[model samples]
Target: MFKGLRETIRAYQERDPAARSGVEIFLLYPGVHATIYHKFAHFLYRHRLFFLARFVSQWSRFWTGIEIHPGATIGRRFVIDHGMGVVIGETAEIGDDVLLYQGVTLGGSGKEKGKRHPTIGNNVMIGSGARVLGSFKVGDNSRIAAGAVVVAEMPPNSTAVGVPAQIVKVAGERVNYTKELDQIHTPDPVSLEIQKLTECTRRLEKAMRELEEKRHEDI
Candidate 1:
């Protein structure tokens, strides 16, 4: 238990540059407090103490402003930076070394019965205000950009950006995301589509003008 606590504090220090010391992180960080509360709540839930588990989870939510359902499965060294407004649904499963920024939601799209939430793979980083809805797998080492609404499954070592989140980068080269959070400057699919349409329109107009000139000469 002490080892886990120490590890959690170390993770916070590594991820957050502003973290001054281990004592400060352990005493002051809401994300750390929330994770500790969740461990106890999850234990109670596993023991079939449903009401108690919910009570503990609700208390944690109230205290930390981070809502993590007791039924959600979270792996080791999971970090939530600036964790306020973060929500993890009952069916959501998070793997090891996952990092989440503020206002991220792992939620359901509808009233689905089982597996309504997303299964996040190891080493994934979800940016702030990102909504990952539906029962899909966000593969290992993938990065979900800020405010991106991901409804589909993402493959390993990929980067997803924009609404209805499209995969912009694949397994070609590794990116050190821990160094910085580059939410902006990602490729915009909407802009690309518009450019393609504009080019097509110009080509059509040129062809039409040439055809009219040929017709007049023939007459």
Candidate 2:
């Protein structure tokens, strides 16, 4: 248990440059506190102590401003940065080394029965205000851009962006950029498509002008 706590603190220190001291992190970091609280809550939940589990979960949410259901399964090195307003639904399964920023939601679409939430694979980074709804697998090494609403499944090493998020980068050879926290560098498919349309319109206008000039000369 001490080892896990040490590892969690280390992860925060390594990932967040703003982290100054271990004492500060232990005393002030809500993400760290939430995770620790969840461990106990999860244990009680597993033991069929539903009321106690919920009470603990609610207490954690109130104290940390991060709502993580007791039924959610979280793996090692799960980092939630500036974790206020972050919600993890029951039945949601998060793998190791997953990084989540503020306002991220791993929620359901409707009133579903089993496996209603998302299953996030290892090394996945979900940016701030990103909504990953429904039962889908966010594959390992994938990055979900800030404010992206991902309703579909993402493959490994891909980058999802835009509303109803589209996979901008597929699982293949590309620039080896490892920093998943680079949310600003994510490609916008909507903007790219708009640019293409603008270029196409310009080319068509040029062709129309050329044809009109030729017709006048012929006359």
Candidate 3:
């Protein structure tokens, strides 16, 4: 139990440098508390104490605002920064060195029985408010952009962004350039419309200039 507590604390330090103080991490951070509580509840779940385990998980969720089912399999060094509104499903499997931001979901889209949740590979970063649904696989070293809704499998070393989540870049290393984590710059619809209008105006001006030049030459 002491070892588990130590490991949980170490996970916090590794993920967030702002967790410099134990008191702050213990009292202020809901993710940290949620993980610690999940450990005990998870143990009970594995031991077939289903009723008690679920009860504790519900209590933790009520207090922490993070919903991580005790049955979910989480690897070592799993980190959730600003983990409010994060939800991990019952059958979800998360790998090592995974980074998740607030409002991330590893959930299902159906009423299936076995393996209904997504399988997240190692060294992956899922951005805030991203929903990775269904029983798909998010390959290793992949990045799921913020507010992206991914309902299918994402290939390894790819960066997915936009609504319905398109893989625009096949980033070999899956680099996270943005400190905000896993967020990619997808052309916003409103911004794209503005750009198109600006380009049309420029083209019209150029056409008018060419027409004036031809008239002057005729004179």
Candidate 4:
């Protein structure tokens, strides 16, 4: 348990440049505190102490503002930065080295019996305000852009952006250009579509001008 706590602290330090020291993280980081609470709650849940486990999870939510179901399976080095309003539902499975920013949700789309929530793969980075709904697998080394709404499964090493999330980059190495773990400058799908339309309009105008010049030459 101490080893896991130590590793969690280390992960926070490594991933977040704003973290000054281990003591600071232990004292001030609500994400870490939520993870610690979930560990014990998960243990109780496994032992069939459902009420107790839920109580702990609810208390953690009240304190941290991060709602993580006790039944959710979380692997090592899972980090949630600025973790307020982050929600991980029951049956959600999160792999190691996954990073999630604030306002991210791993939730079910509708009422389901089992395996309702999404499964997050290793080395995945989910940006702020992203909603990964339904029982889908977000592949390893993938990045979900800020405010993206992903309802389908994502392939490995892909970058998804926009509402209903479209893949922009795939089969490439993960990128970490800044310590803030931001995606503010990532390619915008809406802008790209506008640019394509602008180019098409320019070509049509040029073609009409050429046709007019040919008619004058014929005259």
- Highest-lDDT candidate: 1
Mind giving the per-residue lDDT tens digits that candidate 3 earns over 124-186? Answer: 889899999999899887888899899989888777777787775564555542343426564
Candidate 1 lDDT over 1-219, as tens digits, reads: 778888888888899999999999989999999999999999999999999999999999999999999999998888999999999999999998889999999999999799899999988899999999999999888889899999999988888888789987665765556775676766677788899999999999999999999999999
Quote the RMSD, in angstroms, for model 2.
Answer: 2.5
Provide C-alpha RMSD values for all models, in order. Answer: 2.9, 2.5, 4.1, 1.8
Candidate 2, superposed: residue stretches over 4 Å from native: 170-180, 201-219
The lDDT per prediction is 0.91, 0.90, 0.82, 0.90
Q: Write the per-residue lDDT of candidate 2 for residues 56-102, one digit (tens) a residue.
A: 99999999999999999999877889999999999999998888999
| Winning candidate number (TM-score) | 4
- Count clashing pairs, candidate 3: 0
Worst 10 residues of 1 by lDDT: 168-177
lDDT of the structure predicted as candidate 1: 0.91
lDDT comparison, 3 vs 4, better candidate: 4
Clash pairs, candidate 1, are none
Error of 1 at 176 (Å): 3.0
Error of 1 at 120 (Å): 0.3
Superposition TM-score, candidate 4 onto the true structure: 0.92
lDDT of 4 by residue, 1-219 (tens): 998889888988988889999999999999999999999999999999999999999999999999999999999987889999999998999998888889999999999889999999988899999999999999888889999999999998787899988887654666552354666767787888999999999999999999999999999
TM-score, every prediction: 0.87, 0.88, 0.78, 0.92
Q: Give the C-alpha miss distance for residue 24 in model 2, angstroms.
A: 1.9
